[model samples]
Target: MTEVDPLALDLPVLASLAGSAADEFLLARLRADGHEHIRRSHGYVFQRLIAGAPTVTELGAALGVTQQAASKAVIELEQLGYVERSADAADSRIRRIALTDRGREVVQLGRRLRAELEQTLLATVDPADAAAARRVLVALLAASGGLEAIAGRSVPLPSD
Candidate 1:
């Protein structure tokens, strides 16, 4: 039997680790800014809401979660003042979920924090190298049929 090299992780594993690190950084900064109630999972909801208000069912479909689960999350976010549910303009029979002002602030903060993270990385990594890394990541995402999701800023939750 040959010993496996710990440094030779698969691309998915490496990507997940990098994403987790970035999320942690963003969360910490948000906490400092009084958004301690925000959680990483809320990102999926925010991504979909960014385009427009969506029904709970639509949100669940976008998140790849059960409607019940999506509703539960929305309820939690509503209580935290990050989101609100209102009657749909077209049909009062249906309700739509929208981000609150607090939610928008967190989203804007996250974008700025991500830009800062990139700048921090560039401080140590050459700009060309960073560009190449981005290209590689984009290519990987495209190959996995996720480019559209990225373009739409919608990321589904991972299946259990």
Candidate 2:
């Protein structure tokens, strides 16, 4: 007869641990060298901006966030001088958001920190195992609709 251990079958335990570890790592990297006002969601925003500068509406759509939420993020970013917003020449009503020097610096710092963190975590991990895990996570994210691009929005699990 096979023995079933509750701890081995506890999903919540695994989830809690994973969430805590991720939160700690994020906090460390974001706060690394006195960095501030950056959150996990900003990673996605940065990626989108790198692909190309986008209007707030376009950013919202690409990010899967509402226009208001996107605008609010832009406003905060603007206030921090991380990004600059200017009226579009072609469409005066629309505003274009671009990363400023400081924003770019923050993004680079974040990238370096993340890379270092990954290096630390993968120090002892077999390269094949790490590659597999990365593939699995990418697949899961895509399968899960790639997460909402905005804040305060819920992405339902597959069971629904």
Candidate 3:
């Protein structure tokens, strides 16, 4: 008879703990740095903007939300001076949303913080283990239709 480690069966729990640690770290640091208005929800917009400037409709599609809801969020973020909306150069009738200087700064800060957190966590494990874990995560993400699909909505896990 062979014994299996109980912890080995809790991949979801382990992943959640790892993610929560990074989220808490960013939330605390951002708040301390006087960015109290930003919320995790805002990250959706921020990430999309980082990929490319998108119209409200496009953002809505990407985020799996209605255009009105996406527009409301954009308006709020615009008021906070984190994002700016302008007429599309190629399409005067279309409005595109982009990150303002402040928004860009916040995004850069997040990137830096995330890198630092990764380094801190990886330091506790063997380099090979960390690399292997990353590869697995990448594979999982790819298998699931990539980040856009995963970001758009939450679905119940399939029952075995």
TM-score of each: 0.89, 0.69, 0.80
The candidate that achieves the highest TM-score relative to the unseen native structure: 1
**By lDDT: ranked, best first:** 1, 3, 2
Question: lDDT for each of the candidates?
Answer: 0.89, 0.71, 0.80
What stretches of model 3 exceed 4 Å from their correct place?
1-9, 142-160
Tell me the tens digit of each residue's lDDT in model 1 across 46-141.
Answer: 989989999999999889889999999999999999899999888999999999999998899999988998888899988898899889889889
CA RMSD of each candidate after superposition: 2.7, 6.2, 5.5
C-alpha lDDT of candidate 1 relative to the true structure: 0.89
State the lDDT at 140 in candidate 2: 54
Ranking by TM-score: 1, 3, 2
TM-score of candidate 3 against the unseen true structure: 0.80
Candidate 1, pairs of clashing residues: none
* Candidate 2 Cα misplacement greater than 4 A, ranges: 1-20, 142-160
- Tens digits of per-residue lDDT for model 3 on 63-114? 7788998899999999899999999999999999999999998888888878
* Worst lDDT 10-window in candidate 1: 151-160
Between prediction 2 and prediction 3, the one with superior lDDT is 3
